[model samples]
Target: MYLVGLTGGIASGKSTVSSMLRELGCPIVDADVVARKVVEPRTLAHSRIVFHFGHEILLENGEIDRQKLGRIVFADAEKRKLLNSITHPEIHKEMLKQIIYYFLRGFRYIVLDVPLLFETRKLTHFLNHTVVVYCDPATQLSRLMLRDALTQEEAEQRLAAQMPLNEKRGLASHVIENSASREDTHRQVLRLHTKLEDSMDFLLVRVLAVAATAGLGGVLLYAAKMIFS
Candidate 1:
């Protein structure tokens, strides 16, 4: 299976790109979706989080208040690590299960949309390629400020919490320049999809060839044994 890791800085339009890919019929295993699933009320991860951070983080409905938890973790490195420690393993397990489900259904390739793909560096081994949806720093900051109603300082602090988009672009195997119009971004996604489709074809051929060779060798071995007997 071909695994493509998709990431970008906050407000750099990673979600937009993911939506586009999903519209294009690509199966997306989104980390954010898995994240919410793992932390649902009464789940093991959710229970551990409440125990570690106290009951104050829970909402009236009994769900863990994500915004409250985020405020705690994003403020302190140690807290961030603690949160990751509780959730990452469960997230990984779900991601692997989804990947296997796609493979079983004969998907050619799948997109793993992880916002922290570069930050954790744990996903590198699973990815055959990485794509970064990129915009300039100014554009990124402006978008974040406008989207979240944060002041410049607050936006900068949020940006500071993650790896910069420029550096991520340097590490990416593919880039979608989202500073431009949506049409342009769509074109780039389509181009990438074509490449992925081609790679899928190649992977299928390689798997079939290996199976054919093993089958032929097994048949020859059986014939030789019969002759000898």
Candidate 2:
């Protein structure tokens, strides 16, 4: 199985790439979705967070007030670290479980879409290849402002919180430049899909060749033993 790690800064079009991969039949394990699931009401993460940050972060309906928690944590490094400490492990565990499920089900290629691939540095061990979707700072700011309704400064602050786009591009095994139209991005994704499929075919051939060679060697050894006997 081939595991690809997909990462990019906020509003950098990673979601679009993920969607394209899904449409193309690649199984995806989304970290953000897993993160939310891990912190759902009545979960251990939810309980730990409530205990540490007080009940004020909970709504009257007994669910987490994500906005309130975001306000408290995003602006404070310590609080953000505390939140990550509570959530990251659970998220990682769930992601790994999903990855293993897909792998065992015979998926040749799977994409692990994560926002903080570089920051967490867990991609190195889990991913066979890493793809980073990237755009210029101006394009990122514009898209983020329109999508999230944030001011330029606010968007920039959020962008700054993660690694720079250039750095992510440098670290990635493949970079999808998304500073163009949706059609352009789709073309890039399709190209990437082709490349990944070709690589998978090559890997499969190599594995089959090795197995065949081993089997032939074993058969020859058995024949030699019979003759000697």
Candidate 3:
């Protein structure tokens, strides 16, 4: 199956568009979700983080206090890099597993919902199409401020931390304009879903699936012959 990388700036309504895609029956491998899972209480990433960041970043119940760790890492570039070095590998592994799961399920395509799809450029080469959900700057700013209850400056700082949406739009193979009403956004998502479903790129994945099945059957048949002989 082809992979679509879906991304947008902070508060750009990318998640809203992603949810719509899910409703359309697209399997999504969300990096944010996997990031959280990899750092859960007993995970290897969690142990490494605590070892490095110390117990002060943990809640009384022993789980990582994400907000506390976030504050620490956001202020220190080296610390932020260190944290990424620890978690990114695990996150990538888990996301790959999910992708393989969808591939084996015979999906036509799947979306990788990553907030840093453009910024990182790590997965762009592998994606058949990259989509950026976009909104006008004013709309994006207002949405972030209102949604997060952030002051204008705070919201602006958060937005400034990432690559601009305009840049991401330019880099994307497709852009979904999300500044309008939900109905408009829904229309865009529907069109995108149809486009992906109709693409001939899935033929490559289908071939691989057939090869994998044949390989498995050969192994099983050999094992059965040896057992009965």
Candidate 4:
């Protein structure tokens, strides 16, 4: 199975790429989704967060107030690191579980969609390939402002929280340029999908052939033993 790590800057369209891959039948294990799950009301991570950050970060429904937490961490680098220290390990564990499950189910390709793939420096052993969805900084800023209804300064702060996109591109195995129109992006996605499918097919054939040869050799050995006996 090929494990692809997909990452992008804020509003750079990582989710869009993930959606496209999903449409093409790629199984995705989203780290953002897993992060949320790990911090549920009674989870150990949640308890740790409350102890560190106080109970005011909780909502009326007893769930963590993500907005309040985001405000605290995004405004302070130290707080952000503390938050990551509490949640990252749990998120990684859950992500690995999901990946193993999909691999066991015979998935040809699985995407680990993580926004901080480069920032965490944890991609080395986890991914067979890394794909970065990229767009111009201005485009990302504008889209983020409009999408999240944030002021320019607020948007910039959020953007600053992540590593620069250009730096990430340098480390990526594949770059999906998202600065172009939707049609262009779609074409790139389709092209990538074709290449990945071809590679997976080749790998599957090789594995099956090896298994068949091994089985045949075992059977032949058994037959020879019976004849000699």
Candidate 5:
């Protein structure tokens, strides 16, 4: 199956579009979900995080207090990078597992919902299609403020932390504008789903798998013929 990378600004409704795609039976590998899983109390990443950042970041129950860690990292780029260095490998491993699971199940394509799809640029080359769910800057800032109950300044700081949506829009193969009504957004998602399903891209992986198996079979047959002769 082909891979699709989906991303947007913090409050640009990327998750909403992801949900719509899910309703259409598309498989999704969400980075945010995997990120949370990699840092569970007993995970290796969790131990490393606590060791570096200290137990102060943990809650009374010993789970990492994400908010506390977020505050520390977001305020310092070095700390953020350190946190990523610890968690990213585990996150990638888990995401790869999920992708393989979906691929084996014979999905047409799987959506990878990554907030930093543009920022990280790690998986961009592997994606057959990349989508950016976009909204205007003012709308994004306002939406973030409302959703997170943050002051205008706080929301702006959060927005500035990531690459701008406009830049990501230019980099994407498709753009779904979420600035308008939910109906409009849903229509765009429906069209996108149809487009992805109709593409022949998914056949590439299947063809490669079949060719590899056939090649191995040929090798085995040649060895048997030599032995018999």
Candidate 6:
């Protein structure tokens, strides 16, 4: 299977690209979605996070107060590392499971939509190609402030939490500049999808799918524990 990793900075429209791909029927394995799942109220990751950050990061009804936790981690380097240590492993494991499932289902390609693909240095290991959705810093900053209802300083802090967009552009095998209109962005995605379809390798994909099957039983037990505790 061809594994394509997609990422971009905070308000940079990476998610918009993922949605466009979904609209085109691409199988998308999203780390952000799974990351939220692994931290659901009773999960091990959630428990660890609460323990690390304290009860102050929880709501009155016991669910995590994500905004509160974000405030804590984004500003502190050690806390951010600690948070990544707790969450990234489970996210990667789930990501691999989803990829294997899509491969076995005979898909030639799948999108691994991970916001932190570059931050976590995961591109080299997990992807056949990497796509970075980019916009200029001014666009990013303004969009973030408007969308998240943050001030300029607050938006800058969130932006600082990740690598610069321009630097990530350099790391990418493909860059989708989202600074233009949505129509332009859609055209870029369609062009990229066509290129990926042209590059599929059947024999290699089947071999990898077979190899991945061996780990399924192991992660099921691990997943059970994660869900139960």
> What stretches of model 4 exceed 4 Å from their correct place?
200-229
Report lDDT per candidate.
0.87, 0.84, 0.87, 0.85, 0.89, 0.86
Weakest lDDT window of 10 consecutive positions for candidate 3: 220-229
- Tens-place lDDT per residue, model 4, 174-203, is 999999888899899999888777664437
Tell me, by lDDT, which candidate is best: 5
Model 5: how far is 158 from its true place, Å? 1.3
Q: What is the TM-score of candidate 1?
A: 0.87
Steric overlap count per candidate: 0, 0, 0, 0, 0, 1
Q: Give candidate 4's total backbone clashes.
A: 0
lDDT of 4: 0.85
- Which candidate has the top score in TM-score? 5
Off by over 4 Å in 2: 200-229
On lDDT, who's better, 1 or 2? Answer: 1
Compared with the true structure, what per-residue lDDT tens digits does model 3 show for residues 154-175?
7777787788999999999999
Per-residue error for 104 in candidate 2, Å, reads 1.6
Residue 27 alpha-carbon offset, candidate 5, angstroms: 0.3
Q: Kindly state the number of residue pairs that clash in model 5.
A: 0
lDDT by residue for model 6 (1-229), tens? 6788899999999999999999998999998899888898999999999888899899998888888888889899999999999998878777777866886687878998989878878445646889999999999999999998999999999999899999999999999999999999999999998898888545575664465578665765465345322
TM-score, prediction 6: 0.89
Error of 1 at 48 (Å): 0.9
| Candidate 2 per-residue C-alpha lDDT over 1-229 given as tens digits, one digit per residue, 9 for 90 to 100 | 6678899999999999899999999999999889889898989999999999999998898888887887678678898889989998888778777865885587778898999999978556646789999999999999999998878877777777788999999999999999989999999999999888878443753474466587765764454344222
Q: How far is candidate 6 from the true structure (C-alpha RMSD, Å)?
A: 4.2
lDDT of 5 by residue, 7-88 (tens): 9999999999999999999999999999999899899999999999999999999889987787788778899999988987
**Model 5 regions lying over 4 Å from their true place:** 215-229
Error of 6 at 165 (Å): 0.7
